[model samples]
Target: MSIVNIIEDLNPWDKKLHGLFQRQSTEKLTLIFTTRENLDKNSRLRNELFQRYSVPEYIWAKVCLRLQGYFGAEDIFSEDGSTVESHVTWFHFEIKYPFRLPKNKDRAVAEHQPPTPAQKDGKKPAGYAWYKMGVVTSWKAPDQHTIIFFDAEDSPAVGVRNELKCNCENVKVEPALRNPYWAHQFLLGPILACYDEAVWNLRDHVKALEQGRREGKHTVTNSLDSNDRDLNESSTTFNALHEILRHALHKTEILGVAIQTLNSICARKKIFEEERYSAETVAKEETVQNMVITKRCARKIAVYLDFQLSIVRSLEARARANEARIRSEITLAFSTVAQLDSRVQAEIGHAARADSYTMVKIAAVTMLFLPPSFIAAIFSTTFFEFTPPEGEKVSKDFWVFWAVSIPLTIIVFVGLYPGNRGLSVRKHISSAAHHKATTVGPTVASPAAPAANMV
Candidate 1:
């Protein structure tokens, strides 16, 4: 069999070949490929290329006419012996209607009529077969140039690519169809999976923070030890941790979008492969399944990625506010706990940390003292009998009345105090602060140890 050289001679084709892989045919094939490997391996195509676009309805019609050769010329997306000159001629024709449907009346009809099963969707056609959107076609001419139809305004390839969630901007021909940094590298799983990891991280972090906030744990915003995980931290350490998270949120969002888009591309590849079949047979169920699965996976991944991006952006704002809130509370809590009014502050702090049961008990005890104190205040001076025992009745006065009233008040307060609940809450808060202090405590001398004498 003679070598097919339909696309080798053109400078345009050659330029497109760099960073791109082309499978040299026993014949020349000017059409773009699904992967770089396609250029080197010569075989029947069982897998269809991924659609990286979503074509509008009108251009789809022109592609149908071009495939049917309504231009009175070679099919623009054929595997036939297309020459470089034909490509040049097609380019001239296609550039005319960059965004419009073909001017030819017959082409308009062919595009309107469906020919593929994808258009039928398991239902019998209603007099007219619908068209599949992304099928690649070629137009060849006697000028020895084979025109690739993917870039043609009429070709379904570019338009259908929109179904794929990738960025196809300025997509010129290249020797390779992918970039090393962006390719399916093992360093990270597929792009979709990577996005999933970030989402998980954000979710878990938020959950933990909410729990800590409720419990008065003095939780660190985000942090890392030498082992690369968040651990206990001082106020300073947590401050640094929040700053780092704030910066990473940006990077995480960008990666999330990219991963989602790649997953979508992978998914679209499966459906496209099944759609490659002609009207003859639909037996390749596995191929159909693969495409459908990949498409679904891609769609899901894109959704999550978008969601993650949005969350991270908003989370950045929220976390900043939250971190500041925590920091301020911590500062105030520390000052209160350490001052001369420490027990009073501890009571407040205890209430802050107390369980519902504990808070209820403390509240009950505080309220219990109010009535006796109020009664004493009202009767201390008004009741002369009680006071006379202080004057002539016992030669006592207001001082004596106060003397008895004050002791009774003290006793009442002592009896009504919420002993356990207040203590439990105070312990919980101090324990959290203790953990924070210990994490950074190594740098400082112990409170129990005396300072070393200086020479």
Candidate 2:
């Protein structure tokens, strides 16, 4: 379709399109801000056009909403009719950080000034204490000869625009190839920057987690004194590794989507290659060259995306390895703690057995002296006294006393034997019954009785 027809069909004045188109004339309205600077040498003219075409807040909001919905609801590589027909591909990407934003010190100070009523009640500000935030959605349309990047509130988008403007100004290109070359340059800058940042962050996080695992292993090895501390350290390291793996996986997913999008673009270029060149005539040499340039640039982009995918895959592999290492460390820590506990319990049991043996020896010594002491006490009693009477040298009944004492002592010892034997027998019987109950099977007497009756 002709430019006029496209504009008329688009209806720039319409409510939906007005915010997007309001800032510039329909004929000169290029989505690419960087290219406009190259197309116009005069800084004044570029500024004037930018001011005139600057999208209104309402339109910007709508654009953001559309981008969010498209990204959230559709596959990253899915194509629309606009992409197929016009040889334009639309892509959306996001960069996220796992950590929360540090609270804005200035904002915090301002809120605390004079102590707001909520502060008086000991409550903090209404917003998040540790703000978890991310950049706005970024969208790009890489057309056959023109690449348009929608402005967003994201730092990456801003960085891309600035880099593209600088590259466009510095690079000297033939008039025929300028658009095609710059389009690739524009698309490459943001993607590469983001990819590099993701790789750096992932590497650092993985390194930290690995370091923690090493430290935890060292602690477990050196000191068995604090099992709880060692286990806690291992748990922390494991959790960190899990987080890193999650981040790495997310990065790989985005990389894959990007690679797929570039592949789709390359596939379209290949399909239209013949038709694109066949239409070229002597009158359209410049147009033919531009198409050729665009095709070559698209191929380069696809190759770069493939390289990035490989890098991302490597990062994912590293993360997986770290995860496995952390898991192994956790298992080792648990095993070490268990073994230590078992050893401690065994030592306590040995100590208890030693104490029991000492008590048994003391009881044996006490029993050895008890019989003699009992005999002496019995003889010294009034009934069998052997002490001299009044100053007499000896008692007449001393021999009788000795004879009676010896016999009585022997009799007492004999009498005690039956009681001791009975007690011993009772103990043996109880032990035997217990052993039988524990180990022996019940016996059936019916077969024996039947055999006896037959005999």
Candidate 3:
């Protein structure tokens, strides 16, 4: 099927979606190996050589679906089938790569964007960013091996193309098996390279996190010593690292699946070669050479695949270890902050207790002099003069004053300083209440007793 037909059938709204983007045409990296010319050709065009092959319609549909950012029934697509005189396969997967971080003081920093004011002041820290590359590879029949790299720029793709150029003569020249699958190894090389780069980026990120954690430890120590409770920087760093590790782990899992896909391709290619060999009743010299080369290629690829798997495993293990380390650091930071908070709370409690003691002392002094001052002021008033006018006898009104003042003074003292005296007063009141209750109980029971007897 043609690429246009596949696109039209799979995504009917393709033309409408095109107007939304004001960008240039897609930058696709396509490598086409053709046996007709006995050479490989490079193209920037999308699906130029893919249309020349006898690829199954289903494969075309899968590629179309993947390009549209959707895989209908499965998240991963790996389909292989044989056509007359050729073997075909289609694969699609996403791989991650770290985005370029800005430089600071001749070193790459972990900040995804420019640091905000808080980050600049060391109140917050930033994390790295990663972007996903959607990659698709198609091995078409009748001498076409097409690899398509989408959403990637020229660097890695150019490197792959250059490597293929250097090695394509082996497959094309005489005495060298013209098995195109030999080129498959180089095709997959870039993916492994991408994974290697990603893992290294994560390693760098882990190192940065370790450094940050150590620094945070010192900062927290100082904060604890100085009684500074603000720990937003440490908390922010923890959260950022947590998020980065989560993404890194997920990408590692995808890498695992991708390695599996690579293994599957190698296995299926071997099986296809075997089937092709068995179906030939009379093996020509060329066929024998192709078979030998296919076998050797399979063995070499197996070793390579093993190496790839081990590398991925090692990288994954290291990533998980880094994650665990970051987690431990976060726990320690939290504990440190909690300890600081507890200390601050204890200090605050002591201060509050001291304030209460001071207040009590002031209250005691007030209670000591308050009654006499109040009494003197009252006596100095016109109504109760200590030195009366010569004609006026400081009369019986002074007795009245004494009678009112003495009792009032005693009541005021009892109310103001109700220490043990308050308890004694309460006990006396309780006794009176109990005595009244005892006396009333008999009278109340007398009525009930007579009524009960009548009953």
Candidate 2's residue-wise lDDT over 1-455, tens digit each?
21211111122123332344444333211334332223234444334433333322232244643331112111122254222122333444444333221332322222111221234468654311111111111122222233344432234455555555555443333332322222443454455555555444455555554555457545543345645776676556556555666666665555555455445544544454444345542134336566677656556755664665465456446545545554554566567657777877888899998997787577555554565566667766897656677879987765764575556656554544435665687788899878766544355445556563332
Clashes of 1: 56
TM-score ranking of the models: 3, 2, 1
lDDT of 1 at 62: 47
* Greater-lDDT candidate between 2 and 3: 3
The TM-score of candidate 1 is 0.21
Per-residue error (Å), model 3, residue 16: 27
Residue 354's C-alpha lDDT in candidate 1?
Answer: 62
Could you estimate the TM-score for every candidate?
A: 0.21, 0.47, 0.59
Error of 3 at 183 (Å): 2.8
lDDT of 1 by residue, 284-367 (tens): 322565445544544454454455445445544554554454445455434533452455566778778767667767676666
Q: Which segments of candidate 2 are over 4 A away from where they belong?
A: 1-20, 23-85, 98-151, 155-158, 168-185, 212-222, 227-242, 245-302, 314-455
lDDT, model 1: 0.36
Candidate 3 structure quality by residue, lDDT tens digits, 1-455: 11110111112223322231233222121243222111112221223334443333353444454441222111112253223343445554454554333332334432212232235655544443333333344433323333433333333333444455454433432221233354456556655555665566656666666675567544543365532244565555667667766757766676666666666765665665565446452263237656677566556766765666577677667667766765665676678778878888899999999998789778877776666677768777897445656788775456755676667667776776646787688889899878867776565455545553332
Ranking by lDDT: 3, 2, 1
